[model samples]
Target: MTTAAITEETKAGDANGATAREGRGDLLDQVSASPRPRVSASSSPSPSSPPRAEEIAVRVVGLVKRYADGTEANRGIDLEVGRGEIVSILGANGAGKTTFLRQLTTELRPTAGRVEVFGVDADREPRRAKGMMGVAPQEAGLFESLTVREHFELFARLKGLAKREARAAAAEVMCGLDLVREARRRVGALSGGQRRRILVGLALLGRPPLLVLDEPTTGLDPDSRRAVWQVIRRAVAAGATAILSTHYMEEAERLSDRVAVIAGGRLAAIGTLEELFARLDKTYRVTWRDEFGAERSNLFGTFAEARAFVARESLSEFSIARVSLEDVYFALAGRRLTDAGGAAGGTNVTGAAGAAGETRKEGAR
Candidate 1:
């Protein structure tokens, strides 16, 4: 969408005053209620399964975003997400993950390229595109004075549900997000973790066909994080598509059907965990402390090789195992997992190089 067009829409929405949120809410309800092609399990296979003919939930072509100050947040990025799939985006703090998502959510306009949500042009028909999506931004305001139940009910009603239906929907979402115990408490009285769960619950309302979550479990504890994962898995199992960005490697590895790594304002790599792991020649890793107590790690092509090296080194404190998702991420992102949100320079061995190679292979085919 053009900047001027977005500005005009914002102005119009503001002009509507208190009714604007309600209007948008109603639009969501209408969109969710409309009949569309169903995504069968056979048609929309999971990442672990073979590909089949399925609807595309999201498509981006040569997407780019350049700020007024000349900072390029996204550059010539292209991606496609299948219906009912969960695609996790991983990147450093300034790597443009949020910028990519905001464009998909129509909250930000791209400087170049196209974004389509469920076949609707996101740039040209943002409202129609958004009607099919539920978004939980990294940060958003909440009504502190309102109770949790009130927040859900009010938002549900706005989404086009009748009073009773809204109530039931709110209750269901609360249960799924493990917020039922706090339903009667004011949002202001809740803990940060509780509030974060509420934000995630808000997106699950009405079971929207698509969900865009940015650090949805950021403040939650381990148990709460797992609950949110369950909620996401349940939604996808019921044929919902999700695109989320998270810092947790476990979250990305466990929940995502595929992973996308972004670096320096560009997509560095995109593939399933197995597909990504296949790119590495050294599939086994061994870690140990040297005789002087310094830590060391070695990679080998096979487990036997790693074990043989361990014996040859007479390593007493050491571990040998197959490479993990974190290894793949480090390889592709060219940085340690902990350094994910750090400064923008690393090995440059993965990401851009890997993605370019994949692009070349596709072109050749």
Candidate 2:
């Protein structure tokens, strides 16, 4: 997708840009020694038409990250997320999902490309850009000595809340994350899932306009995971735009407005779930047990075609279903969703180029 360039009139330091950066650092510092966290006025807003560059919450152009060991984790990635939209980045284990998020959060500096958050250049002013966002890294160190409530309250204060506001915010977060019952318990005594919840709660303290979460529910039980999802939904309902990386297809399908598939350090495809599903010709799926009792599956353009294939194969037991996001993922990445390792070269079946080519062909026709 092409992102319109930010006009000089909207570049940082302009009157409007200054308003965007205002209170990002000063307001919080005024309340305490803690740096002020900047938040956009609203994470989610109803826009009747396409958003302009200045309206984007995050913009990444030609982003590239190369490590000292000569490993390139990202390559020429271009993405734009509008205010109030939930965008999910999906990929195999080493397909650069974390790398992309880290750069967006300013946790890791990119070797090349430009990143802008809320109109501020992240590369030149990471701290200022970060003030506009709440980030929950994949792994973070929590103080075991702090109680759950203490952790939330303290972090709220650190995010620039006053004493009374901090307490109220902590209470709200605890209730939202279902950590109220464990509020007074020390972090060290909490289970892994509980600690994970605390980490997520910390990021939500001030209801920052943007939330960048890297697998926020990784270790939680199903119930806890659902609770977290509710918290995220509530945040979005209140106008928070969220970007997250998740292994759970259900999470992506349910939570995201758009899904981005990354492969070989590049964005393989990005669109709504329906748009991605449309990329595949085989929209029908057939599954059956072979003579050896092993499961076998195939895809066809239609249910009738799939049924006919089963009949031709003399399969007695088979099921036909609509295509799912997993099929789109496998088609794009040329591997199952659960597969690990880097994007294997020449293995992508439906990458960005292929998708673009398909679009061009349709337009030509």
Judged by lDDT against the true structure, how good is candidate 2?
Answer: 0.71
Pairs with steric clashes in candidate 2 = 38-131, 43-84, 44-84, 44-239
Q: RMSD of each candidate?
A: 15.8, 15.1
Worst 10 residues of 1 by lDDT: 2-11
TM-score of 2: 0.79
In order, the Cα lDDT scores of the candidates are 0.72, 0.71
For model 1, residues 1-365, the per-residue Cα lDDT tens digits are: 21111010011111222421223333322322332222211211123433333578898899999999998999888888899888999887778899999999999999999998888899999988888888999999889999999999999887778999989989999998888989999999999999999998888888889999998888789888878887887788788999999988767776777888887778878777555555555555565554555544565665577667666766566666555556556656655444555433323323231211110011110
TM-score of each: 0.77, 0.79
**lDDT tens string, model 2, 29-130?**
232232112221121221223358767988899999999999999988888888878888888887888999999989899999999988899989998888
Candidate 1: count of backbone clashes, pairs at least 3 residues apart or interchain: 1
